[model samples]
Target: MASAPHSPLPVQLTTARPTVDGDHTGTHLGRAARRGELVRLHRGIYTDAERWSDAPPWERSTIATVAAAHRSPPPVFCRESALLLHGVSLLEPPRDVTVRTRRSPEAGVRRPAATFRRDVPPPHPLRHHEAPLPAGMSRPERRDALIRGDRGLEQTVLPPDAVPWCPGPEEGLRVEPLPLALLDTIPRMSRPAAVAALDSVARGSRLVDGPVGEEDLLAWDGFLRTKKARRRWESCWAFADADAESVGESVSRVLMDQWGLEPPQLQVRFVVDVDGGSRVRVDFHWPERGIVGEFDGLAKYQKPELLAGRRPEDVVVEEKLREDALRRLGLRVVRWVWADLRHPTRLRDMLLAVGVPFRG
Candidate 1:
């Protein structure tokens, strides 16, 4: 109901068998789809009428496909096949199914609506998936079986030895380890996908219930810092002390506190001269002194690529213009740079000289 019941435990390799049961008529299936009772994913893969109350079925199936591959190994789903199996996020959603596997199956194996990819392991195969299955071939044996007829137990990953990386549900067709999944996906996955995975397992909430091992998650922080690709996620870094709603604001808040200035109400808004229809949103506000501190970052005045395209003179001129405008409205404006945050105490003294008391 919530998720396609975890692939029936001990499920068999269904490659040579019918994916869907032979029970009811196609008409009943058609009616359900028409009534939105059964949402058809791809073709024969159908999910309950009601999707996961939250995420789409694709995400659920990503888990399921991986399960299927595990239930029946010797055909490690990979590449596009692997992508299809894991529900890896793609821009236009891939048409050709990809997978990474050392060997290819029969020559003319045909899929109903998707093309199966045959991948040779890259030096670093994305072989991060693995899990041990129950030791049996019973009614639900198919859920964790490897070969046809549920013959033997073959691990799912192409190189089963590289089990530390893959994320799956269990030992046999099990879900990959959530942390390893996050790490494996970080370099290759889009920010949203990678972020989603990280958010799912790495959130403060999950950490509470997690069985934390001796491994230090923060060790990866240094590597993430040097990425230079997208630093916005740094907001979640263990050292990022601010709780700004967005990463930019988070960085700004961290700097403000580091500088020892009394923290300001973020996104502060106050109406200005009514007739002038003036209004301002201060990045930080010294409410007691009516002094506003704005943290300037490239995203606002300059695009990320150009870093600081504004001339130093232009920056000074703009700051002056803004200061004048705020002063006209009876508000004093102060600015902070990225460097100031490194020595927030110095900035704090400056604020104190300007009549803003420091609790220090």
Candidate 2:
């Protein structure tokens, strides 16, 4: 007789659970409650030791997801769980799972110190993603089984004013994303932080045009609840003597403002009736000082009919063409790379040497 096909190795914990069907259960254990081929996790949870490696890292979190889905006392997956489900790059490393029960919070002490929460998700615009799974795999499986529940969470995007709380230095919690992870990690970031994050994105070969909708900015603007409205509106689209605004431009402005330097006029246009009637948009300009602070982000130098498919040297020439245009206008450009802002003090000094006064 042929043997039954074996389950994929549980890269995390061994389990009888089928990889996709989500089922694995034992009817009863005889007196003395003996078991076999055990792989212990925290407690009460175990992996069928036979096949452990096939499971991936996410599998470990599977226990939380399953427990969350089938709580006898329903749980809301709030706080850290809520943040995790929402894909917030910054979140607390989860320990004891939390839940809000429709019934009552689980009585008796659970080994992992479970916490009770109100059974509901927070408000909206903070989007949540719900996923369904098979029943039998709910609680019996270990971390490997945790991977079964799709990120079952519903959340509104965090409110802009929520000041993202994440792991920090000297703290032993699990770190979430690297200091600079996803390009949009700063979607709801505070102004100062957004400045830092945008600088990180700008340095990479990655920025695309800003997402057209102003919903996130609009939300943040309303929620700031301080004199920041003026600063935000001003910084939202900072003028560099005569340049249009992008996050890079805004960040450039913030650096100047925070450091007490002269802010440039934004999107100030200078027109010349060229041979074929061509028009142009510049990034930032300081007319009196004949200076322009240009952010050479991907857009300015990576267009398709231009550098996108060309050799990198060709890309350098494309940048030179733009620099030449500003030079023709008698503007002295102060170019800031992503590194300049990492040390704001030095950046302020650099500008000061070129005639701006930074009180710093």
Over 4 Å off, model 2: 1-190, 194-246, 269-279, 298-306, 357-360
Which window of ten consecutive residues has the lowest lDDT sum in model 2? 120-129
RMSD of each: 16.4, 16.5
lDDT of 1 by residue, 1-360 (tens): 111121222211111223366654545555655665554333433344333223334344343343344433424443333433333322222233333222224222234322121221101112322222222323244333433444432213333212222243343332233233333335555433333333333323323224222274343333232344225444333333222323334444544454565666667776654336566667677787888766654444443233366665676675566567777878877776545544656555656666654545
lDDT per residue for candidate 2 within 1-360, as digits (tens), equals: 011112222232222223345643422211111343433332233343333223323332333333233322233444334333333322113344433221122322244322121221111111121221123343334223334553332223232212222211121212112211221233344565455333433333222222222343453343233354445534533322212244455566777887777667666665533433345556666667777666655443534544546876776775577667766767676776556655667667767776764443
TM-score of 1: 0.32
